[model samples]
Every structure is written in C-alpha cells, then in structure tokens.
Target: MKALLLAGGLGTRLRPLTENLPKPMAPVGNRPWLEHLLLHLKREGIDEFVIAVKHYPEIIQNHLGDGSRFGVQIEYAIEQSLLGTAGAIKNAESLLSDRFLVVNADIIHEVSILPLVEYHIQHKGLVTIGLTEVEDPSHYGVVQQTDNGEIVRFVEKPKQDEAPSRRINAGIYVMEKEALQWIPKNKAVSIEKETFPLLIEKNVGVFGKIINGYWMDMGTNERYRKVHWDLLDRKCSFPLKEKEQGNGIWVGKDVQIGSGVLFLPPVLIGDQVHIGERSVIGPYAVIGDGCTIGKHVRCSETILWDDCKVHDSAQLSNCIFGYDLELGASHILYQAVMNRTAGVLQG
Candidate 1:
C-alpha cells in the first residue's frame, strides 16, 4: 500500500523554529521530525510515499530526495494554493490509485498500522481511522463510534459539552481510493468537517480502531521539548543509538571537549560538539551536533540544537536552543523564548 503525508501546513504554532524550517524539517532528536516518521512507516512494509509540499518544499525535497536512502519510492505533490486536509489528499489522487495510508507529518506515534489495514480490508470499509482517548478533548477532532467499531459521528474540535466521545481522531487513516470521489478537485475541503460527515449521512462505512502506545503532536515548543525528553528517557521507541554506561560523560565522534569540564551522565553529546571546561553538563541533557559550549556553564534538562554556542558561566534549565544561536556568558535561561536564531545574552 501507498501513503500520503500531509506536509503542506504552515505550522504557524511552532514559530521561530518554523520561521525558517518547515515543521517536518524541524529536528526532533538529531534528525528531522519527518525522518522519524518515514523510518517508522518504512519499517511497516509500506514503501511508496507521496508528500504534499507547500512551505519550504525544497528543503524537504533536498533532504529526502527519492527516498532511496530509506528504501522507498517517494513522489512530491506541490500545492500551489492552500488545501485543507481532504483537499490535499484529493490533489494527490492521481498518484494514490489504490488503498493507501494517510498521516499528518507532525504527529509522532508508535502504534502499528498493519492491523488497521487488515481491519479495513476485512470489513470493506471506505475509510479506517485510528482513534485514541485524550484526557482533554477540547482541541481535537473527536470521533464517536458504534459498539462494532463503525463510526456514528465525526465532530471537528467541538465545545467540551458538545463532544460525543473522548476518543479524538489520531490523524491517521487507511483510505480507499474511491473516497477521493467525495472530495472535489482544486478546492479546499476538510475530511472531518466536510467529507467524513457526508459519508456518515449516506450510511457509508467509516471504522475507527483504538490504539494504545506513545503518541505526541509536536506542534508547540513545550510539546516539542517533551517529545525529545521522551525519546531520551526511553518513554517512546525510536531508532537512536544507546550510550554505554561509563564514568564521566561520553561524547560522539568529531566532538570537541574544552578544558575544566565537569560532566555527568545519562547525557548525550552529538557529533562535532565543542564543550568548554569547568562547565557542568548533564544528568539529563541532550546537546546536538556542532554546538559550542563555554566555560563554567550549568545545564540540566536542556537540549541545544546543531551549531548552537553557549558561552561561559551560562545556566540553562528545561530549555531548548535552536540552531546557530549564541548565548553569552553568565546568562540564565528558564522557560523563555529562544526560537531558532542566536546572539542572546539573557534568557
């Protein structure tokens, strides 16, 4: 089966980071967020992919190319005009001729898709959507299903009291090719608001499969930070190298460690990083590639992206520093904004 990846959104919520890089290109650990999604999907035996591109399309195209590196054939569908979720899929209809999977590029989940595909085939449903229960359902498109798993209602971001169920849409679906007929071409349409409801009204079969696993929507700074922490803490599963238990801090290849360093473990230092001595690092920290760390710095529960430079005596806690930014000496940052750029002396 093929897959349609929704990559056209502007990602306005993840500003500063999304100011330059597309949401899909934003680094989750050391790699782009979309990289993890693609790797996961590829492992599931779904190789052919069609990515809908809009904002910073070239960056994704350049990085992923033809998907040969991941053993998949990738095609690009550029959206000249803005298309909503359903419209985006319709725009790529020519390429997705058979049963296919649809996923929001910004969502990260460990749930398996194979079962959902099997269920769709067995029931001969037009669409099979993945659903998961969330504590607070105010912000999500909620789904209400029958006892036998057929969806009875589809509501998009309903008021708390108007919600029929706490089972929110997981933004993952296995769609039949014929579902595209319900969506008009060259027009903006939402599956939740427009297409899915129409199907339910016509007695079409739309099934929901509930899943239990690690899932996250990395659309905000806070959630983005938490996603990284989850990966580092092994709360979620991903293909990342594990560090061997040892004394002092372990640094990766091409790393530059400066003098007077006080290092602590469970910390991961990526390739080509520069660390200044007398600086206390880690306990729970992840420093990305090519970062420059200054002297006497104290950091915990912080992640610095590639090429970020933190000067001497700087103290950072529970913060995320984006790429190519510079932090001056003695600066203290606590729960502040430092989105993707550099040269800040204070938090």
Candidate 2:
C-alpha cells in the first residue's frame, strides 16, 4: 500500500532546532529522524510514499531524493501554503490510488502495523484510525469505540473530566479513497477537526485499532533525547546498525580519534567522525557522522550530529547538537538541544 507522510509542521516546540531544519530532518541517533520512519514503513511492504512538505521543503527534497537509498520510491507533494492534515492529503489526491495509510512524520512508534492495515481492509470501513491508550487523554483527540471496535464518538482534545475514554488518536490512519471526497481541496482542513468528525456526523463507518507498543512524539528536546536513549537502551525497535566489540570503544568507519583520549562505553560512534585527545566520551553517548571533537572534552548522555565540532575541554551532558555547529573551548552545554542552525539552550 502507498503511504502519505505528513511532514509540514513548523515544529515550534523543538525551537532553536526546527528554527532552521524541518522537524522530519532533525537528527536522531546516527541519521535523519525521518529516515527511521521511512525504513519502518519500508519493512511493512509499503515502499511507495508521498511526503507532504511545507517548511524548508528544499532541504527535505535534497536529503531524501527519490528514496532509492532506502529501497523505496518516494514522491513529494509540495504545499505552497500551510495545509492542515486532511488538506494535505486532499492536495495529493491525484497521486493517491485506492486505500492508503497516513502517518505523522514526527511520531516514532514500534508497534506492529500489519494488523492495523488488515483490520481496515477487513472492516471495509471508511476510515480506520490507530488508537493507543494513554494515561492522559485530555491532550489528545480521544476515541470512543464500541465493543466491535467501531468508533462511536470522536472527541477532539476533550477536557480530562469530559473524555469518555482514555484511548487517544495515534495520528495514524488508513482511509479508503472515497474518504478523500469528504475533504475539500486547496484549503486548510484537519482530519481530527474537519474530516473525521464530519464522517461521524454523516453516519459513515469509522473504526479504531488499538496497539500496545513503544510510541513517542519527538516534538520536544526532552522527548527527542529520550527517544534516542530508548533506541540505544533497546526500549524501542528500529532498524539500525549494531556495533561489535572493538579497542577501548566501538567506532564506525572513517572515524578520527585523537591522542590522550579517555574513552568509556556503551558509546557508539558513526562514520567520518574526528575525536580529539584527552577527551572522555560515553557511558551512553552517540556521535553522528562527520563530527569533529576537539581536545580534552567530556561528553555523557549526549548526542552530536554530523559535522558538529566540539572545541577543547567542552563538556556536554544530556544534550543534542545539530549539524555543522561549533562549540567554544570549555563550553559546558547541558540539556542543550538544537534543530538546523546552531541555537543553544541555557537549560
């Protein structure tokens, strides 16, 4: 089945980081965060994808290209204006055929999606939304379903006291082509606010498929860091290259380690990285590709993206540094997170 990835949001919560790059391109672990999503979908036999882009479209276009590297065929639907979730799908109507799956680019989940697709096909419902039980349903669009899994009510961000169920929308859906008829073209429309509710109003068939698994919305610095650690900690399942035992540490190809370095593990270093001497790394640190670390540095619980440079004696803990950034000597960056261009968080 073809998939539609919603990647147009401004990523306001991630600030400083999304200030330059799109949220989908934000670095997570060793590669672009969106790569993980694409890879996940690829494994599910959904190799054809259409990404809807608005913010910094060129950057996403340049990075993903035709998606050949990941063994998928990718097409882009550029929105000149900000189109809401349903609107974006409506805009890409010409490319979509039959039933399709829609996913949010910023969401990371390791749930088995095969069942959800099968459920949608079996019910032949107008739409089937993936639901997950959350402790706090007030912050999300809660779904109230019948015993047979048919959605009975659609509540969009109801108050905690007013919510009928704790099951919230997972921002993933399977919809028949006819569902697109409910959404208008060339206008801002939200599936949660406009389309889904309208379907319910018209007494159309809508169902919910609940899944229990590791899921996170990487829309903030803390969650972004947590997601990376979750992957490293084996809390979430994603396709990633594993490192085997090596001298003092496990480093990827083309790595440059300088002299006088004090290394520690459970650390994973990516390709084309440079590390300076007298530096202490890890006890859970992930350095991305093409990074340059200067002398006498200390990093723990930190992640650095490609081409990032840490100057002499800089200390980074519980932080994420974006691409091509340079840190000054003795720069102590804690809980610092960035998006595209360099912007430091004091906290």
Candidate 3:
C-alpha cells in the first residue's frame, strides 16, 4: 500500500536538537529517528511512499534517496509554504493510490497496518485512524468512538478533566481517495480541526482502530531520551546492528576496551569507539561512532553522538552530546545537552 509520510515539521519542542536537523532526523539508537518509522512500515509490506517535506528538505532527500537502501520506493513532495497535516496530504493527492496510509513522521510505533486496512475496508469508511490508549490523554487528540468502532468526535489537546476518552489518535490513518476531494485545493488545513469534523458533518464513515503496542512521539528531548531507555528495557523493539557484547551491552565494529573499564548493561557503543582505563559507562549509555573516551571518565545515562571526544577524568551523567562535541579534561557535566550548532543546556 502507498503511504503518505509527513516529514515536514519545525519541532519547536526539541530546541537545540532540532535547531539544525528536522525533528524526524534526530538521532535515536544510533540511527535517524525517521529510519525507524520507515523500516517499521516497510516490514508491514508498504512499499511505495510519498514523503511530504518542508524544513531541511534536502537532508531527507539525500539520506533516503529513492528509498532503495531501505527496500521501498519513495517519492518526495516539497511544501513551498507551511501547510497543515491535511493540506500536505492534499498536496500529494496525485501520488496517492485510490486508498492509502498516512503517517506522521515524528512518531515511533510498532502496530501493524494490515489489520487497520482490513477494518477500514470492512466498515466502508472514508478514513480509519489508528488509536492507542494512553495513561494521559490530555496532551493528545482524544478520540470518542462508538461501540462499533466508528469515531464520533475528536477533541484536540483537551484538558485532563475535560477529556472524554483515554484513547488518543496515533497519527496513522487509512484514507480513501474520495475523501481528498472534500479538502480544498492548495490551502492550509488541519485534518483534526477541519477535515475530520467536516466528514462527521456530512455523515462520512470515519472509524478508529485501537492498536496495542509501543508508540511515542519523540518531539521533545525528554521523550527522545525515554525512547532509548525504552528500547534497552525491551519495552519497544527496533532493529540495530551492534552486537551484544554481554550483559545487555551492545557494541559495534573495531571497539577498544581498556583495562579496568567498567561496562554496565544496556549500553550501546558504535563503531571505532575507544575507551581508556578505569572509565565507567552505562547502565543506560549510548556512545555513537568514532567516539574517543579518555581515562577515568565516567558516563551514565548519557548519549554521545558520532565522533565525540571526552578528555581524561571527565565525568558525565544524564548528558547528550551532539556530533563532534569535545569535553575538556576533568570536566564534570551533569544533566547537560550540547549540540554542534553551539546550543547548550546545562543543569
């Protein structure tokens, strides 16, 4: 099935991180966050994709060119101006199939799409939104559905006391082409605020499919960090190449471990990493490719991006270092986040 992947959003919530890269491009588990979504969809047999992008469009185009690397055919639609969710899909209407899937690029989930498609077909609905139950529905689009699975209302970001349901929209949908005509041409529109409400008004069949599995929108640093820990904890599953060294510690090619170095489990170290003597890493650390760590350095619950260097005796905890960042000797960084673009947040 053809899937419209929304890849264009200025992730304001993920400041320093998104300051230079798109939200979908943020690094998670040693690869681009969006790669996880693409691979997940591909595993479900969705081969053709229409990626709608705006911010840093070329980065996405260059990285996933033709989608051949990931075993999928990809076509990109660049938005000249800021177009809301439904508007972006409407812009790519020509590339869409008679019936297709729409997914938000910033979300990570493992729910299968096949059943949702079957459900949509069975109900003869114009759209079938994937729904997931969450502990807190106040920050999401609360979905109210009938016992038969037909969506009766959508409340976007309602207050906790005002929420009608704990089930929220998971940002994955199956939409029939006939529904596209209802959306006006070349205009900014929100599917949640405009299209879906209009569909309800016209009595168009719109249903919700509740999916049970891991799902998260990594639009903030806290969420981003939580996802890594989640993957390590086996709360969510995604493919990675690093081999598990032992005790849940995964390492990549050409890694050098020095004497007296302590490795706590659930740590992932990428290729060509060098750790010096008496250094401590993990419990939940992710060290990226080409990193150089000095003697007596301590890292815990931290993420070091590619080629980062930590000087001797430096201590780090709950830190995130962007690509090529260098920590000075004996530096003590705690609850800090730094990016290559010179954005720094220190606790």
Best by TM-score: 3
Better of 2 and 3 by TM-score: 3
TM-score of 2: 0.92
**Candidate 1 overall lDDT versus native:** 0.83
lDDT of 1 by residue, 1-347 (tens): 89999999888988866877778888876778888889888888888999999888999999999999888999999998888999999999999958999999988788788888888998888998888898888898888888889998877788889898889888899998987888999999988889888887777689999866788998888898888778767788686643434653446777767777767766778788888878888777888888888878998888887888888789988887778788877767887556655465454
Q: lDDT of candidate 3?
A: 0.88
Best by lDDT: 3
> TM-score, each model?
0.93, 0.92, 0.96
lDDT of model 2, residue 334: 70
Q: Which ten residues in a row have the lowest lDDT in candidate 1?
A: 241-250
Please write out the lDDT profile of model 2 over residues 1-347, one tens digit for every residue.
79999999999998877887889888766877788889888887889999999999999989999999889999999998998999999988888869899998988877677899889989878899998888888888888888989988878788989998999888889988988888988999988877888898887789998976788888878888888778777788675553545542557887778887766876778888889888999877888888888888899999888778777788898887777777777667778776545443222
| TM-score of candidate 1 relative to the true fold | 0.93
The residue pairs in collision within model 1 are 259-277, 260-277, 260-278, 261-277, 261-278, 325-342
Q: In model 1, where do residues sit more than 4 Å from their true spots?
A: 156-162, 241-251, 340-347
TM-score order of candidates, top first: 3, 1, 2
lDDT of 2 at 243: 58
